[model samples]
Every structure is written in C-alpha cells, then in structure tokens.
Target: MKRRKYPKANKMMLVSLGIMTALSLPIQAEEEIFQLDETVVTATRTEQKVKETPASVEVITRKDIETMGAERVVTALKLALNLNLSEASMVGNQVSLRGMNTNQTLILIDGRRMAGEDAGSTANVYELDRVNINNVERIEIVRGPVSSLYGSEALGGVINIIMRKPEKPQSTIGLSTGSKQQNASYHLDLGKQGKWAWTFDTLFTDIQKQRRSETTNMYGPRQFYNISGTYDLAEGKNIDVFYERMSEHLKTTDYTDDGGREYFTNTRNSYGLTYRGRTTRGNYELRTYYNELEKNTDQLEGPGSYSDFDRANYKTWAIDGKNTMRLQDDHVLTFGGEYRTSEYRGTRLEDNGDAVSTVTEHGISKSISEKSVDYQAVYVQDEWKLSDKLLLIPSLRYDDSNRFEDSLSPKLGMTYHFADNFRLKTNFGKGFKAPSISELYMKMTRRPIPTRTVIVIGNPDLKPEKSTSYDISLEGEKGAAFGKLTYFDNDVTDLIGTETTRAGSVSTSKYVNIDKARIKGVELEAGRHLSNNFTVKTAYTFLDAKNAKTGEFLQDRAKNRYSVQLHYDDAQRTGISSILWYEWVRDYRYKDDEDKDTDYNYGTLNFTINKKWNERYSTYFGVDNILDKKIDELVLEGRLWRVGMNYTF
Candidate 1:
C-alpha cells in the first residue's frame, strides 16, 4: 500500500481559508445543536423517523454529505439502492432508477418540481447546482411508485431536496480545492424568536481544463446562490419563500477522425421562485421558473468553422394547493390540485466561413418552438386505521393535458405492526407519463442541407404511457440495531423511444402501446453501533429487468450494488472523528440484437478525518478514491477522482 501525499493544490485551499478567517472578526457566538436521527417529511407527507417509514426510503443527512466529500447532490445518491447515471450532453445528465427511464423519476426541490428540462432528459439532483448544499437540511429519497402522492413523473420514485431553515443565529464559511477544479462557499443563517427566519448561501468555483477524447483545454465553471425564509403569522400558520439562481459554463472536447478536433461550449442559467403558506384549513403553494440553455462551438483545429450552434429554453409556472382533515378517530383525508404550464423553444444558426473573415450567415433557419403543455391534475388520498396495529391507505388521481388524453390512477397500500419493533408494508399503485414536446414534435437535421430528412415526426394522437407497480417492505429496530428490506416490481406499457429502423440510422419510432416491461428488485439496509465509539452502516441491492411479453431481460440494468461505511468518534482525543467507506457495483451489459454479454466490475474506497478544536471551530480532511482506481463509471468516458477538505465556524 502507498501513502498518498497531499497534492500541492491542497495548500491553495489552506491559504484561501486563512484569508477568509483573517477578514472576519470574531463576533457573537451561538450554540451549535447537533441533530442526529433525522425526521423525514417526504416519505409519508408527515414527520416520521427513517426507521419508521413504511416505504423504501434513504435519508441522507447534511452531516453525511459533508463527511463523504460529496459536493454535488447526485454524488450522495451514487451509493443508493438502484440508481444509474449517464451524461446526455454538456448540460444534460440523466439518472434512471429501478430500470426506469430518467423521465419516469421525479426530482423535487423542497417538494416542488425543478423547472422542467427538454422532455427526454433532465439534470439529476447533482446537476442542480442552484441549491447550495450548505443550505440543505436533508434529502429524502422514496424508492418505488409514488404517483399516489406526487403526480406524473413519480412513476419510478421521488427525490426531495429539503432546504435548511435557520434554527438559530449562525454563519459558516468554507473553501476547498480538488483535482481539475476547486470551489469556495459561504452561508449565513438568521433566526428571530417567534417572528422570522431566513438563510442565504453563495458559491463560486473554477473548473480545471481537461482533454477528453480530443487534446483541447476545456473545463466548466459553476456559480450559484440560494435565498430562503419563513414568516410566522399565527399558530399552525406560516409563509415560506425560496429562490435560487444557478449559472454554469460547460465545455467538452471531442476528437475527430479527419486529423482535426472539435470543442463544444454551453452557457446555462436557471432561476426559480416558490412561495408556500399553511393554515388550519389547508396549504397552498405557487411557483414560477425560467431556464435558458445556450451553446457555442469553436473547433480549435479543424477545416470547418464554428457551425451548428443552438440554444434551448424552457419556462414554467405552476400552482398547487392541498387540504388535510381529521374526519374521525380512524380516518384522515387529504386532497390536492395542481396546474402547470410549460413552453419549449429551440433556435439555431450556422456559420459557413473562416475564423476572422465572416462570409455566409445561415440566419435562424432552425427556429422551431412549441408551447404544447398546460397540465392539470386532481388527487385525493385517505388513511384508515383498520385496527391498533393495521392501517390502510388508498389514493386516486386524474391528469388532463392538451397534447394527451386524460388518465386515471389508483393506489392501495397497507402497513401492519405485529410487534413493537417490527412492521410490514405493501403498496400497489398505477402511474402515467405524457409525451414531451420533443418526443411529440421536433425536426432535426444531421447531414449537409438539401438532403437531410426529418428523422422524428410527432403523432398528434399520442397516448399517455402507463405502469403498474407493487412494493413490499419490512422494517425493524431494536436498541442500536436497525434494518430494512424492500422488494419492488413494476410493469410498464406504451413506453415511447427510438428503435433501430430499416434505414440503419436511427429514426423516431412512433409510440406503440406494445409489450409489457417488468422490473423486479430487492433492497436491504442495516446499521448498528458496535460500541459507544464506533458505528457501521451497509446496504445491498439486486435488480432484474425484463420484457414481460418477450421474456427477455432488459438492457443496461445493473445486477448488483452494495456499500459499507464505518464511523468512529472520540471526544477524549481532541474531539476527533473518522469515517471509512467502501462501495462496489457490478457493470450493466447491454442486451443488443447480437445478445452479447460484456461486463465490468468496479469499487471505490474513501476516508475522512475531522477534529473539533473547540465548540465554535472545526476542520476536516478527506481522501477519496483511496486506491486511486481508474474505474469508468460510464465506460468510454474518462475516469473521475474527487477529494477535498473544509473548516466550519
């Protein structure tokens, strides 16, 4: 084994932190309250312990995110039960869950959908640089069908990003430097007793230049800010407002076969505003968002000039209102309604000349845009206590959209407690998804003008896709030991995507209400405290995806994934704490027409050490990719290694 030395770049982080400390004078001090055992509000829409949630849910605490050396949102999710990550483009990253498409999984920021991206793909949790991690309280992940609670995109599940609110007056500053790039961040929290509370966080990072396939110097810079606050009006009544702005400069280099190289650059800006109010009668929320994605390409060394440039923009506004009432000793009822309007615009212009000498401008010949969706949905759910140890939950929802016909979904679930420390829950549900504008109506050109064909055609009569899902879970806890096991299966129909055509090149295959697809999987999680000084946590997942009609396995589904973590903390040793983690994942083989079986297995090990000098100050060091293993998370793409540190005050 080799003892890896700290890179000189690490000193840059220390120097930056020293300057931040010297600039701020020691002012007022506040009590630092440590919150372990987080209470989740997303799994059931009510406060419950992670161990008590009947569904398969993973709750990542802010402490866990910080200690794991994870800066982005999706990095924390990598070790989750069954999630797959892929890069769609410079600005687009896709995440699929339980062998479902990316669009089937819903992403929620404080219980609201992020401004929707172009239909087929979306930025996952990590791509949302808008929300600062310093402003996050905790993340709640509900795995399996949640369309009963959240409409539409929740067919796979829901990931809710809960932002941090000021519990007390506090402020913290942090700086970190890592391979290829580095970032600096700050957070300010203010709380006034019985009146108001708010938080503000900002971050800036410079990305390092890297050569992908091509030998071009390219890197992406990210900057973002978050502002959120709450106002108390009366008992059980409050108002919450949140806003976020994110900007990033993304660059990608591609090697060409004709002794030339190509470089792509994209500028993305996203902004969102949401307001919510709750009263004794009910709750209401209103949100509006705008996202602009523009791209500019420059070939550093090529015969052709900067050509085939484009931009895509999405704008959305939505309103959601709900009410909950306790009708009887055994019955609780909830009802909600939501409306959303979204618009997508695509524009492009091509250059036909040299670098300095501008010759032909193709004008904006490819300005095809559509404002196709204004969706509405109404939902209701009821929880009935059949007995002291038995409960039943039933829900129904209806969605109406202009491009697609109406849909009705129903869900039934039950949770039974046979013992004080053990419980069993089973849920059966139906879900649906409407075609995106891109899928229904888009014209793209690939070859040189005059001869390119419209590869994709819209079917004005496209129908909404649907799925039926079932999940069974068991949870138990005794003293310091906790464990959970879940099994899930989903059958999908009328999934829309492109398939190989007779022409050899891919063409848009019309939506076919065809064969049934099935995804069956199991998840196990366990955690225990070995002693007062040591704790261990681990999880494993096994998945099988197949076509119910053909009896053949689905493509690109990982067979096995597992993770283990150990933590040790000692107050006697200068308040020192340490954590060691290892993760393993089996590669997913594509089941193409040839029936090939190619596989790859990879693992990662990481460690972190932290010391609290006193109550008000703390510093931490972390090393990731401990083995320096060059594992390609996405084969054909470059490998990744991340490490950093932080000091909080």
Candidate 2:
C-alpha cells in the first residue's frame, strides 16, 4: 500500500480561523469603534450593516431613485452600476453584468429570487414598473461573486430590491401624464409602534402606442396594475407580500386584416410573500413566490387567410434560510441554505383546415410540457481581523441536487487598509449553476417545404456549469469626494446555449452545454461635491470578453461606456433640485448580426427637476432621449418622456 495525500481546503480554512481567534484575545472592547447603526443590506443572507461587512456594496436609496426618475429596476440598476443592456434578435431584453449573460446575474425582490420569463431564457425587465416605487425603501447591489452567500445564479453578482416599511401612520396619492404614456400610484401606510404595522400601495400605468421611423405603428399600448402590502407580526418579526399584473395590446404587423380587425396581446402576473425575524444572536427569513405569463395573436387575413397562436405559462416556488453570529472576538460566522423549483408549460398552434374549416377557430393545439429542479445548499463563512488594519474572509459551500452532480465551492478574500481614505481588497471564489429546466427539457414541432418534422429531447445526463472568478477593488471615501475602481476576471466551463442541427430543409435548435469562455472587465465610478450647491457623478466601464474554446470575441459586450450627472439644489426658496445628465455607450454585439464588429456610437442627454411645494406635496418632470435620437433594439421603443407628482398627508 502507498500513502496518498488529499488537498485540504477545509483544513486551510480552519487554520485561518484558529489564527484569527488567537489574535483577538486582547482586542475585545465594549465600546464600538464603528457605530453598529442600522443600515439595510440584502447582499448577505442576514440584514447586516454595510460598514460591518467584508464585501464591496452599493446602496440606492428611494429618494435617489425618485430623483433619477427610475420607473424600471433596470434603469435604476443602469444608473447605479455600469452594466450593458443588449437586445435579442428573436425576442427579449438581455442585461450583462461584468460581461456575463443576464441569466448569470441573479436578481431578488425583498430577498426572494425573481422568476425568469418564457419568451426567452432571460429575466423580464419590461415588467419592472409593476413594482410600485412608492413602497421601495432602497436597493442593494454586490458587484462581484456572492455565490458563497447565495447558492446559484449569483455567478456575476446580486441585486436586491428591498421594499419600504410603514414607519408611521399616513397616506398619500399621486398622478402623472406625459409624452406617449402616463402612470398613477397611491400609498397607504399605517402602523402602531411595535404591535402591528402595515403598508399598502397601488400603481397603474397606461402607455400609448409607438410608431416606427416610417410613421407606421411599431409598438402597441401597454397597461399595468399592482397592489402590495406588508404587516408586522410582533417585535423583531414581520411578514410582507405583494401582487402584480401587466397587459399589452397591440395591432401588430403579423395580424393584419382586409376587414380591419387586428389583435395581439401580452400579459404577465407575479406575486410573492416573505417572513422575517431577528434574535439577539442572529437573524432568519423565509420566502415563497409565483409568476405567470400569456401571449396571443388573433386576426382575419385578406383572400387567403390563416390564424395562429402561441401560449406560455411559468410557475415556481422557493425557500431560503440564513443566520449569522459573532462566534468569537475576531471571527464572525455566517450559515445559510436555499431551495427552488420551477415548472413551464407552453404551446403553438395553427389552423390548416384539418380539424377546423375556417381560420377564425381557436388554433391552440394540445402541446403540454413540464420540468422541475431542486437545489439544496449549505454555506459557512468566517470573517477574521488578522491585525488592526488587516482582515480575511474565507467561505465554503456544498450544493447538492437531484439534477446534477454535487459540488463544493471555496472562496477567500482579504482587505488591507493602508490609509485613512484608501484600501486594497481582493477576492477569489468558485461558483456553479444547475442546468435550467428550460435547457434540460424543451420540445418543438415544425413543418417546412415538402414534409413535417418533429423534435423532442431532454438531456437528463447534463452536467452543471462551473466558474472561477477573481477580482480586486480599490476604494476611497472622504468628506465630499468618493471613488471606486474594480477589475475582475471570470472563467466559465460547460456554458449553456442553443445548438442547431439541420434535417432536410428544416433546421432545429436546442439548448446545450459548450466548452468554456472568459470574461474580464474594469469599472470605475467617482463622485464629488464641488460646492454647497453643486455636485457631480461620473462612471466608466471597459470590457473584453471572449470565447476561450473558440478564441473569438463574446457576443454583445460593449467595449466602452460612460455616464455623467450634474446636480444643483436649494434647500431654501424655490425648494427645487435639478439634474443634467448624459450617457454614452459604444456598440458591441447582436445575436442576429453575423458581423462581429457592428460597432455603434451613441449618446443621450436628459434632465429632471423636482420641486417640493411643502412637506405634503412634490412635483417632478423628466425627459429621456432628449434629442429624440433613434436607438434601435428588438423590443424597446425609440425615445420617451414622463411627468408626475407626489402628495402626502
């Protein structure tokens, strides 16, 4: 027999943990060097203060959201972080974080995962307005690896949309109308100290149809309605819930009639609930969610008329738990777990006079499919202050599921404060994602040319995708000036995307696992208060992503992006504050375009002004794409403007 050695990631972690404990013997003090003041953070499993954490975090307050006129979460995120928003050739919106697919980026509403759409394998930002901003307190974003805290889909980073709580007993209403569209929202917040508290909000949006460059109808009218509320259970406990629905009606080109009857509709529904509690030792939370979607097209053709329809519905449920403790003088430990399951049902039908004589009959055939996935993970993290200015954070997680092979992920990071206003930080982590149900099982039927073709497949033996990510950030914060710069690199294996095959004259495609890819980028942001009445914010991002297996540039990664904002405020007199802003993005890739260098250079300038008549009311106006320049995308409109008001009593 021969002796063998195995790499001990856990042993290394324990050694670091022990050393941290030994060094903290003499540093225990009752006095807080940093005020443990309450600050909300959903970046971690626990709602901890931002200053006490060992990770880089950014918070977007509700006040800031209103000032920036952020009606959609994506717009709020775009203003907060330098992310790339790309349009899909087929149908949908794709957002990239740190040059990774939008699916790789995880988004949460009040700490629960937001479900993906059926139109494509992507999250729908189109329905963001359904989330009433009047009930949002703030948003937290962690721009780097968070899989050590969150299980999967947090490969690139995490975005948490935290809703507001009713801190007082009050009510408010608002209305607005503007170019091409308008919206109205109302809020009612009632609470009685620690016994019971509740907050309710309602929002409605009716957007006018849009036209193409040729003055022909391109996009149809859209309407949305939402109602949500939260109730406090008891001291250190609470329950929150919400419901949302959106609808779009369009006279589309695909549904044209000689008799002048046209029809097309898209609708979505989403709702969820969350319960939370905090103890002297740690904190705990639980959440559950559901979403549904349906789309239809109906019409009567000229002489040779035909009808078709497509429908899709999605459903999901999830549970997550986390806890944190100050185990020792120098070591803070965090532990948590998560589970999620999703199902999809869809169909496409056409009337060819086989079962129905006329094209006016409902043509949705009986095509039903179902898929489900289960994920369970447990993670533990330790934060050790090695010295007065040196700190180390190491974490490990085990993820097991019925869908793929189990995996163990390890992460290590350090932060060294060398100056009062400067610090150096670095982190490396391993992350993985279970195959999405959509990728594992999808069926399609096609009839082309002379004959018909049918394809049905599910890769039950598929493997989980994995990635290794590393990043370093330099940050500085002073009285009125602050700046941050981060550089990160990601190596992904077993990437999932569509693979196409040809059969006779028909070509069919399905999602499959591929070799590998690499994404690298740098992000910079700076802000300064020049004077008592003047302030400025600016940001820049440079990305270089490629397919390591093919040595080709990755699709849809912009090489350059920049944004600038100037603000002025007067606490006295007019009670008005205004901002002038501009943004520039250099073109990158589109899935439909064969040319790799389809570069585009475009910029936009916009302005917003908010005036408070008194403590009870405020009015504001905003105009986007001020020059009305054409920015082409598959599902997005050209340019638009909005005006609104807020009142409280």
Return the TM-score for each candidate structure.
Answer: 0.82, 0.82
TM-score of 1: 0.82
For candidate 2, write residues 60-160 as lDDT tens digits. Answer: 87766767665556555547665655544323346567887777767776776655453235454443444556567788877666777776777777777
- Score residue 395 of candidate 1 by CA lDDT: 88
User: For model 1, how does the per-residue alpha-carbon lDDT over 525-598 read when each residue is reduced to its tens digit?
Assistant: 77665667787777667788877878776655666667677888774534777788776656454433366545
Candidate 1 residue pairs that clash: none
lDDT of each: 0.64, 0.65
Model 1 Cα RMSD, Å? 10.2
User: Model 1 has how many clashing residue pairs?
Assistant: 0
* lDDT (C-alpha) at residue 438 in model 1: 60
